[model samples]
Target chain A: MSCRPHWISPRWMISALSLCLLVLAVTALMLGPAALSVRQVCQACCHAVRGQAEYDPVTRIVLTTRLPRILLAMTVGAGLAMSGLAAQTLLRNSLASPYVIGVSNGAAVGAVAAMFLVGKWIPFGAVPVLSAASGLMVTATVFLFAQRGRNFGHSLLLTGIAISAFCSALTAGALYLAGERLQTLVFWLMGGLWQATWSDVLIMLPLMSICLIGMLLLAPAMNVALAGQRSARDLGVNVRRLQSLLLFFLAVTTAVAVSRTGVIGFVGLIVPHLLRLTIGADHRGLVPASALGGALLLLTADTIARTAAAPVEIPVGILTALVGAPTFLWMLQYRAGGRAGV
Target chain B: MILRAEGVRFGYHIDQPVLRGITLELCPGRVTALLGPNGCGKSTLLRCLNTSLRPQGGRILLDDRDVMAMAPREIARHIAVVPQDTPTDVPFTVRQMIMLGRYAHWDTWGQEIADDRCVIQRCLERMDITSLAGRLFSELSGGERQRVILARALAQQGTVLLLDEPTSHLDIAHQLEFYRMVRELATEGQAVLMVCHDIFVAPMFVDVAILMVDGNLLSCGSADKVLSEQNIAAAYGVRAQISRTGEASFQAQFK
Candidate 1:
């Protein structure tokens, strides 16, 4: 809508976005307090690949510190972006995001509590598991509320809002209770890949891949659904089943990412909208494009978050919201043309 | 395709049945006009005929196979429905919108084939919306949207076409054109059942007329025979005289 060069193809846009992602990945690997050169990063990666023992500082830094953090950032960004695309498609609302389902707020509650309570060795593993469970439970609650009415989308949105608000209140209560480790709790809530490890990467990578491929497969079905639920049903689509599968994939994807990385908000909201504008609204292309766009966005934001200030690392969530909110608003204002009237 | 509904009964709530003891069949090579007053469950019956709604008390058969037992894609491969209103604010080209009609024609992983492209081109041409093919769906006017919807349904290439209030948004000329298209489609062996309100003009285009009142089927026969003065009055609660509008068409004048 905003005067894009129509000659610029969506395929080119996606390729460019991927290239940027790769470039950013390289740049992010080399940037830190102990600024490794490109050569150091490559040598460390090669050494790790060959299964060399890592008494070396460079391999430890690259493999354990930057690489997992980058991988985690990419997965989380991609997962949330795909979830947003799924939500927007299923709800038939351009403004809808994965967070509209309230799962992240539930994860916030689970994570905030897990971060503070049970002092001695509840295990770091409890955070993501507890968070994911609570997030899923909240979604189940929203689904239960949606089942009471005929207009499932309307009911789901309203119920998701109510539950999310309630969860935010619960999270606020936990924050208030954390008197000693309050700063650490606030930092976690602000969200970052500051604590990324190989375990986190291993946990999220497979799920992200599966969701990406699943969303790609469901893209055409989602296109039919954009015509409205009843009409989609009339066209021989199993609307109920499609809705359930979409909700499940998106909800699980967002819940896991939020469990691991706290609540990073705008990757979901901005990535789909941005890619929809660039790649057009055909979900067949938009789903994969969104994954690339989101990875690029969050990876860039994380790189800036850590390196912007010399010593104090800013939360990646803060940077994303700060960047994403304005960019979304600008697109909405300037790109408010007939094609974007939806 | 013969879509047969046997003693179909449906109700949104348990106590209030919108369609009660309805028995009918939509046969190919004939256009069937479902005529009824407001709240007469004509739309509900159309939905039932397609796989959109299940009858609470009766079974709908599609040429000996149970409609309920068939998978959605299987049913969709044979049946195409143009709902009363589809969301048009979606950001898809008219071409892409019509392409969605082929969702049931192929598997989940299947790409758009040569046949799909040919069918889409035919639909676009048939609806006289070829020039609007590359235009955004949200930019179309109401009548244009209606035509696009019709094209999308036709693009399904199904044997059965179910339309509900399709001509509501059309101008008189477009409405006539739409009915003509429906008749032509019926002549091509598509079982066409459309929920229409214009008892006066319907007899001109449709081969059969089924009249209803308060969810009860009053009469169903050849258009001339079923659309009598008495049947018109019974369905609409009005006294009217039937006048021949054309060789095979009739119009009603109030007494």
Candidate 2:
């Protein structure tokens, strides 16, 4: 019955998470096959910024290779986490994530199809675009199907799950047709940050920023929405309009992230839930904290994937699932133990 | 504030109707209990008043203004609803849950300003849940949760408050306490309308009783006039005996 507020308020949580993300970004930039010290990384960055550094191997690796990958990781992680938070709130289900609505599978199908048609006629640059388009198409289908009922959130979750399964099957068939390119296709499906480029970062950054800002602005509506649809309407939330808006933004952000990262999983699901456990469910705090927490989790997992095997690099998705699944299970057990206040 | 519904008609299916041309008015500073058997459209009528369900054929007016033309937020600034048995999965603290009542008043960034915080604190104190402010809403018991929801509705600062089966799940003591709170709310100049099944207890606390049977209002008057033994038997289709327990209190025994 203690009425005292927690000492670590949401503002403090956000600040601490921001600090963690900054430290992780710096650490991620320092790790990789071609190791660079912190000083070397900073000098390379400054040199690149000033356009005065010689074309040294260290500078090239740090600037052209590692930096873009880290930025891509951060953006993709933040975007997916934001989308996941929206999905959870919209559906009123804790297990919901960015991929719950088939965005990742749709992107996978697009990327695999792009790989098939790449050498024939389609250019390589069209992969992310096609991926994003297909992801949106899938989302639209789910949205339309869910809109047919009064219980939109529940129907949406069910439709998304069914479509997600179907899309995965299509992706599998595309992989089967990709006989010669199986290894590369499987690598992409498993997901990695090694292929990130400055172009990927440029494309994803603005899109994620817009969606994230929009979601933050709509955070109060999202909080009211957690009171259930009837209560949401009573609280002056235009439930239908709010659901559509949130679903649209979630689809855009998830599609953009999946198109770039090629089907990374668990970052969305794990980050938001963990932040909810620590910071509570106010979307005002949950959105930004989830963004940073997701970035930290994915970047750390990517770092471990890169350094753990030295030469045979693990797909970052594999590492995240390996860690995330156990953590989620542990959390479920903890909550079941009655200490989680759930 | 006066909320009036004129010839409100609603139905789920094409042929069968849930609410049949119902008309009612709620005035400020009065506690009116909507009492009926199950599936009598008492809940539906409350929904129509709260704008959660739009009646197919009728118009609701708030202060003689068309309610249909008003924005959701504008309607929310006047009428607040407490729904029945709403279970949520989100792990929000009691304070955060109450703060959701201020959503219509929030600015674009939805920041909790000083006045919003003050309102929330006052609501918590009014609902006697200041000590439970830090507890998770999902962790509270049914009675505590009901009070929390009432606190949230109070925080909405609405003049007309509608509750759908507010004490349907509470113990006898909690049920009495809930009606006392409703009476307190009425005395504070808020109009209170509640859908209730406990015909025995409602007559003791509510100033007015609205008896509905099969989507029709059977009686609307003072509790003694509306909740008489014959009216209760007709509304519930059961024999009932009304015995006066005190000068102003009465209890019904079903035979």
Candidate 3:
């Protein structure tokens, strides 16, 4: 579809998205199970910053529980969206996502196995490392196998689907065998931020920061690459190297996010696609915009999951899919209508 | 710079060659039309010359240096290719698409500088697509998209421009406009080699015509000398009538 002349520029779009994210982040911290007011949240934040112990339950809940969860959601959301942007560009398929390419499932399998074998002994920190390794291996295998022909995008997607199915089956079998740990395994697989701590944020912040910066720095090459492999080559892009590097980073971002949050779907797919439609597909704008848009989306979704049922929290992943699937369908319909010259 | 392909050989399979011992030289300020029947090696040879496809046997030299030794970006600084079909799935605006041509000149992070923007503007004006600068590339008509692609190639500022069947999707008027742009580019000191299927239309715009059949060059000369009835029959397996319409134009009627 043609781009309508909206008064908003790319810079304006980024600023707006960042503002939305800020508002959403503050709201998420303020409204949770304990339901602290804005003043209490701000006061708690200030006291925590100044290293004072007020010893109030409201401040404790606000600083210790809600703040880490909010930060984790923001970081995971940004990481997934950036990964999805890279995946879509690298595969040249808008349908591609971190979950679609089997990396999330691979990480899920690794995280599940780590949960059974090492989650008790090595604690929560070791799961992401193990999952990142496994996810990287799976992504590399898919790349090697599907890189044979001219239509690599289609082939890569197909290979990823196959691997994803296999990984999902393995994860299911692990869940079945988990027995007493079934609730924990199922909770992780459905995706929740309940286990998030400052330690998890420590692991997520640096990894997501590196991957996000890498995606932005490589945005120009990725822009040229949208012209397809042959044109990208003629335009001076080393297509193979660019694809490899982008895919590597995509796997890393997806792996780290999934291992920490446990198989959150649709954030990676929906955020980039939605941002591309609204702002056009210039990766220079798309990457950062997707980052902000993604943080806003997941923050909003996780807040709803935390507050919608109140005493009972629905998994964030279910809410995202429920929202993302219909939006994705509408996107497909719009694209089809556009192609029909309507 | 002079682009010379010497004894180049290539094939999809080992035993069957698509291009066999092909040799040609393209000089600046000349427009050369490559004409051949379907399944001939015209497009293959063009790809080899541009370093998109590597020849197993010979060397392609640009200004007496081997192009294979150069990095892809280095080669791209001297050669630009307008592919048969441009990707429409990406939602890049026309101006942004044209700016992508400056990729070779960009530094490590590949940010577009002020000069790159100026070049993009110049190319857009040169191609007469300034009015469509804000339009999405996917939303443009076939002709507008083709011109935008040409503008991108011009923005590359390469000495050699290679086009593969550029008019396959254009109407007759757009095709004429396309070739006129090519002629203008060549006159401004770029070597233009285009694979064209229209025998009658190509002779009107190009300075030289190269005919290929069965992976061999059958004729390489002025259009009047190369599009003779005998050469057409031998290369295309058809009877043809050739008539000189003007000083630099000829009509070929195949029967």
- Candidate 2, pairs of clashing residues: none
| Candidate 3 chain B weakest lDDT stretch, 10 residues | B245-254
lDDT of each: 0.86, 0.86, 0.86
Q: What digit string (tens of lDDT, one per residue) describes model 3 on residues A171-194?
A: 989988999999988888898887
Instruction: Give the winner by DockQ.
Output: 2
Q: What docking grade applies to model 2?
A: medium
Q: For residues A1-342, could you state the per-residue lDDT of candidate 1 as single tens digits? A: 232222236678888988999989999999998998989988998889898737779998888888999999999999999999999987889899899999899888888877765566578678789889889999999998997979989899999999999999998888888898789778778888988998989988999999988988888889889888888887778998899999999989999898888889889988998778766787777888899988899999999999999689889999999999998888777666523434
Error of 3 at A157 (Å): 1.1
Clash pairs, candidate 3, are none
Docking class of 1: medium
Candidate 3 docks at the CAPRI level of: medium
Cα TM-score of candidate 2: 0.95
Docking quality (DockQ) of candidate 2: 0.62
RMSD of each: 2.0, 2.1, 2.7
